[model samples]
Target chain A: MKDITEKPMQQWISKDNKAEKALKRVKQNTTARIGIGRSGARYKTDAFLRFWADQSAASDAVFTEVTPETIVNLGLFEIKTKCRSKFEMITRPDWGRIIEKDQQQILKEKCVKDPDVQIYFGDGLSSPSISANAEDMLQVLKLGLEHEGLSVGTPFFVRYCRVNTARTIGPLLNAKVVCVLIGERPGMQTDESMSAYIAYKPHPQMLESEYTVVSNISRHGIAPVEAAAHIVELILKISKAKKSGISL
Target chain B: MNNSEQAFISAGIDIGTTTTQVIFSKIRIKDTSGFGFIPKISITDKKIIYRSRIHLTPLTHENEIDALAVKELILNEYAKAGIAPSDIESGAVIITGESAEKRNAKAVTAAISEIAGNFVVAAAGGKLESVLAGKGSGAMTLSKKTGKRVANLDIGGGTTNICLFNNGKVEEAICVDIGGRLIRIDSDKISYSSAKIKECIKNLGLNIKEGQNIYNNNIVSDLETIASSMTSYLTYCIDPEMSLPKEWKDSPNTRLSNRPDIITISGGVADCIEKITSDSFAYGDIGILLGRKIKESTLTNTSFYQKSDETVNATVIGAGNFSFEISGSTIDYRNSTFPLKNVQIIDIEIDNTASTIKRKIEQFCSEYQNSTFALAAEGIKCPTFKQIEETAKLISSVFNFPEYQNKPVIIIIKEDMAKAFGQALRRKLDNNRQVICIDGIDCGIGDYIDIAKPVASGQAVPVVVKTLIF
Candidate 1:
């Protein structure tokens, strides 16, 4: 890690930005990344470097791995999709969705059947997100659901998991509401952001609109713990309505 | 598309030095997040459903507020609006200016709120009045919209509340004892003069006093001079570089660090800014004359002058509409009992070690011994789970105090980490006590926070923070 200046973007004003003080205050409440000064017609060196670095980091996140130790640390058993490796997972999207017969047996034997809610983690696009947020998010979501007296199924890890894997997992485990916390495709703003895909009574024939999604869960965004609490509340809503996503 | 929205009946009552006013508003809250996203609740709409006529604040004695009479007045407003006391869900009853100094000021405010309805806040102070008037008058919006510095002078009977806004944010709210009705007149004579006005008369060698004939040459001319000086003091407050009169030197609360691009006027005197008649003593007070002075002063002539959207009902309207805010949706709380009023806050730097943070919390609890306060902190941009666990341990340690065991432990932070921090805190408490951890509220020491019952399908709580400083 480099010791770099992480000044609140609002305070990074150029010497002659004229609106320096106003820009600083505007930056505090301002959501957009504006006021980046320029040299001639091009971005200033700092702005160019930052933009370049963030984009590179986003692309690089796709190739990373969620370490085995992290899975052990979180007390989650690991399972894999039909896709053999990261290369195959990215190239064959359909293969990444369906769990194999062997994995289905593992899920049936290891995971509780007919649970009110089933929550699991997957390293979909940005493995760093799972490594960064999985522990805290799981801790809050698990405790919050159990506190509400809802029976939650065994939590586990899915390698090369696509979001639609919930369609297969939900039917196999008899989970009324299936939730998968997966890494979102990295953006310039954050590579450590995750999304939670939840579905009620998911099946192989289910439509994409049947799943509810909460995206941008990270330290710089909604925060994993906050997102987890929100997920718990949303799960309750889905349970009461007997539906999720657009239908509910 | 499926949409859900909840509307609340709000009431705002202001008892000031000269007049009392009440306003009712319908505030609607809705979850703005799209179907798949997490809930983001906000006050979607606020409309003034009813605006009560300005009534002379009932005073039992010159030095005492008539609490019973005030209660009757609010009840009368409720009847006139065809609303019941039980209908009001949010809003505030604020006592402002010289009226707040009355012997029974606190009792009068309390009595008035009791009749208005539950959750109608009873607060009295000039600074709070200053902020409210600015927001209500639309001066704050003007600055925010134009991205320029704006200041509002709510020139009431006994005080002028000056609120400075920079890019819509309050820079500072300064209240001064310069207003229209500091000296009252009736039947061609000076019927009353406040202590501050008497000092001004003596300082300027005007020779004005109670019972002085208003028709006399010196009395009428001297009063005009006093009004002229009062308007200049307001300008001096805005731009300290101006020639400040000798009279205000003792009251150093006049100087401002930043100059405003525009000055908007509110309160009763705002209605009389343009001349209509020659009679100055028509209201049996110096209000009309002072308004005339403000209209004639350089304050009106400069580019820095703008008329506010409201005139007489600024404070009440502010108390009604702009007082309440919705907490962030992703907060953490369980076993909740809400509508908690007057919860104070203690702000500490987040970078400080947990032990150091605990010291600040202990000091605040000791200082504000009678009240339960929230531990408010600026949060780390992104904290590791280990960091959250460590901090939660320090936060839960505050429960060691015997009194805090049963009461809800509240923690408010500026970051969006309340859910994680709150979960960790619950683990530390073993779910034995109620814990309220909400984020996205920025507050500091001495601020009184009011938390409403959860709304938007229990995803968030409606909140109002009052700086009730006299």
Candidate 2:
């Protein structure tokens, strides 16, 4: 990768000063590609190169895998989905949402029964987001819930996971509320953005609106430590309302 | 729109030396944090809903402010606007120019503030009034729109308030005892004269006194001298350290870094002067003549004199607008600990050591002599859960000392970790003491912040940040 320049790169070589100044002001607030000077109705060399660089980074994030050392550092035991490879998980999304018959017995033996809140961490699309924010976010959230005197179940990690996996895992653990924190799809703006999907009671027949989601958890968006406090408060509201998602 | 997005009613009352006016406005607050994120609440829109008819400031026998009459006037205006006092959420009452010197000015301001309902602010200062007048006159917005430096001269009844705006922020402000109502003309004789006007007359060697008729020979020259005095001050022709006129010596000098590209005149005399022709004293004063004199005098440094959106009601409109700030949603607070007024924010270095934090707290306590203040730390260094916990422990150690015991601890952080850090501190400290922690407000060291109680439907609070230094 090549480093970009610190000074502003002006796009208008023909010299409309007012338009150039306006573009500069807009560029200060956003990272989207804009105002790149064109050469004969085509993007300039620098702009083309930068676009390719962002695309390559987004591609890399999708194929990456969470490391074993990271799971051990966060003190979480890992579980596998029915999908064996990244290719299978990407093409067959339904396979990633279910656990095998043998894995269900293991889940029940290791997890607490009838817990007030159960939390899960998974690498959905970008492995960097899980490795970057999950440990700190989990630590702060666990502390906050304990302060509120709520019973939190044993935390675990899942491999090749999809969002719908909560529907199968919730019933097996007998949890009243289940929250899944996973990486979001990578975009040119950021690759480490994360999302938290929470459901009151997970079942196969639950509608899409039955899940309440909080997304864009990153350093530039919502700081992971700050997001933890909001997550705990949201769980309390879900419990008191006896509902989640659009119903709450 | 979400349930937290609601509109609030605000009212602004300006009690000036020559006139009193009222304005009501509506402010819209909405959550913009988007889906699946912490709610970042902000005020997105403001509109003026009502503009009251301008009224004369009623005075008592001793020329003091009549508090009862003023209260009745406000009540009538609210009734005319079809609003109850309880409907007002936040606003300000500003006493400007000569009215600020009245013996009962404080009492009148307090009376209006109580009558205006909760969250209404009471303020009396020349510099703050100058800045507000500039904001209301559209000088601030003009600077932002045109990207040019703007200077506003608010020539009201008793004083000429000047404020310079660059990039939509107030750069400099100064007030001088030069205005349209300084000399009141009744029929063909001078009915009333201020002491400052007497000094100007003596400086020009004019044979004039109270009750004397101004002949045609000296009237134009006298008015020209008054107008030129104001122009010379704005153009920097008058030396502030040595040759500043005695009338302006009491007010601090204006400090401008660059010459303004546009000059705007607001307040009561602005409309009359921009037309440049008036025969009669319609307001029973020298306002018309003063306006004509000011029009004739030229400001050599400025390129253009732009028209403002407001004229006489500039201060009241500014007071109604631009008077509140909404806090971020994730603040740590209890319902009983709010509506804090005039709390000073003493900024400190973001040190992780507990001893350094203790020293700064002790130094602030000794300097302020046990006055209640909020500890405003800049963005935390390395904002992780462990780092935030360590900072919280450091704060608890400083506030739990013998000298600072039992005081409600107020902490303001610049980052979004207020809830995390606040909860950690609460768990570490004794349960007897109260804690109020807020975030997402980045204020300078000398600034003062006032926090109002949270709104009924939203958890976000309203904050007012002010810098009163000249």
Candidate 3:
């Protein structure tokens, strides 16, 4: 393995020079890597270094914890899945889908029962993603729901969570619709990408097709405020159709 | 609202010196984003549905445009096209070349654009007229296909507009008062000649006056001298001995470093030249003779002449298709006070200090009469949380100034950070004033923007950047 402290080779050779301008124009229109000139059929030093850096960022996003300030700023109480530790949470994904009995009792006592809409923030795989996007996303979601005269239930954050956590809480709080904003699996391109999974009348036996998802909610992807706006509209459409995902 | 395909009716009308024409088109806008992805709306298709027959521009006896007659002509064509004025959603109306110099030109153009329905109709100057004609004549595409520079010479009734295209994009342009109808011939009688034409006649050492019944040989040779002078302007980038009009002298060439690869001719004169008719009295003027002389002129430059796809109707077709842009779907703005028109857009550089941002706003306040100005900037490149917060704080500080305390702050960023920046700005302002911040549309200083209300998706707004000042 290359030394983590050393920088990669950054030089690129070109005779035409105009190719550099054309490459810049192409690069501005897309996020995909293009025009990274090679050296003797090998990757350039900068390119190799950038690849490793992004890989480390993706892993760091998965291992880090959500900041306490973010939770407090959004006024969200904490909950945890049945998984005891981060190692066990990654090894046994099934445990992350189930809330413990004690946590279920806490949710039932605190959340508003039979609400029109319930919202959740989960640090699925990337804690930094939630901390980066959750504040603005939560505010917009609340404002949009309130503007349409729909009551939102008590919101909370879940640690070591999964998308199926919504399935567990929907029955406990008796929510008509459950929307969970969770961090997506980290990719080398971006680690802060988040996804919003929404289900109408979610239950334990609900198929994956019954849940609608809006992925790529981040600064590098869709702006969080715009994502919330889209989510509000999507939820309204799902409610009117009484369906989601493929059905809607 | 259904997230499906939506179509809007658009119109393009060109009122030039010699002819007036209109074209109606249908633009199909749809959400191109895939399932489970953020919405991305774009104009996927444009089809010309109706093309009006070319009509002679109505002129008054006093040498000005006949406004009522022009209005009636457009109305009659709309009736023939089987569409009401309300059918046109967006498009442009260009009063080009000599027609733009008429006494009631602005009013007539504005009225025609208003009559065409809810569309943008602004008069275009010579430079823009040349670019539009080149785009309409397919010279732009030809340059792109060959990967070479092409210069379009649109020779109309009163001026020859030249637009240079390098790799399918317009680089520079110039328009000179050299055209076919500058010398009017009425049944062998030299009935009238513009002052510019008389100067050319004197330079050619020909005894010609307004009332002389000149022979065809004398007029044809005189037309050849004038055509050679125009070609010399194209070749040398400078007219010798002020043979052509001197108005465009100060507007000199900066892009003629090397000879263009190809030169294409369009407009009415080009139509007559390509037809190659023997009769000199065609169209009751020396237009045919002038065209033939221009074609036969010996240009020493290496540029080769090529035929254009469109001749007389180039500007009209280009005005129809190339002026409107659909904004990115995910924009941030208030819906209640939209469909704004004629908003002056001022370009700003991203400032690092709060005082600089205030100074920029103050400079804009002193420069323009309108209280509301759209500030455009190349926003934060990465748009991280810290960058967004700093940008928002700077903008909110400018808005909080005493001069613009209660006014709405409008920001137009070139980057895709409009929503987040707007949200941050709102938090900073504490919802004190209205803020409309939209991105995904690139515009520069001195360009006016017309933003329509949000479409059915309720996320994006249709935008038209009006090049009114230039």
Best by lDDT: 1
DockQ of each model vs. true complex? 0.47, 0.57, 0.29
Per residue, candidate 2 scores C-alpha lDDT tens digits across B373-409 of 8888876632788887777878888888887776678
Task: Tell me the lDDT of model 2 at B117.
Answer: 70
Q: How accurate is candidate 3 locally (lDDT)?
A: 0.76
How do the residues A11-98 of candidate 3 rate in per-residue lDDT, one tens digit apiece?
2223344677455544555655556657889877766767778789889888888877788888998889998777777899999999
Question: Could you tell me every candidate's TM-score relative to the true structure?
Answer: 0.90, 0.89, 0.80
TM-score of chain B of 3: 0.88
Candidate 3 TM-score to native: 0.80
Q: Rank the candidates by TM-score, best first.
A: 1, 2, 3
- Cα lDDT computed for each candidate against the true fold: 0.84, 0.78, 0.76
On a 0 to 100 scale, what is the lDDT of residue B171 in model 2? 75
Clash pairs of candidate 1?
none
Where does candidate 1 stray beyond 4 Å? A1-55, A63-77, A85-87, A102-117, A147-154, A174-176, A237-242, B252-254, B346-372, B400-403, B430-432, B468-470
Residue A214's lDDT within candidate 2 is 86
Number of the predicted model whose TM-score against the real structure is largest: 1
Task: Give the Å shift of residue A99 in candidate 3.
Answer: 2.1
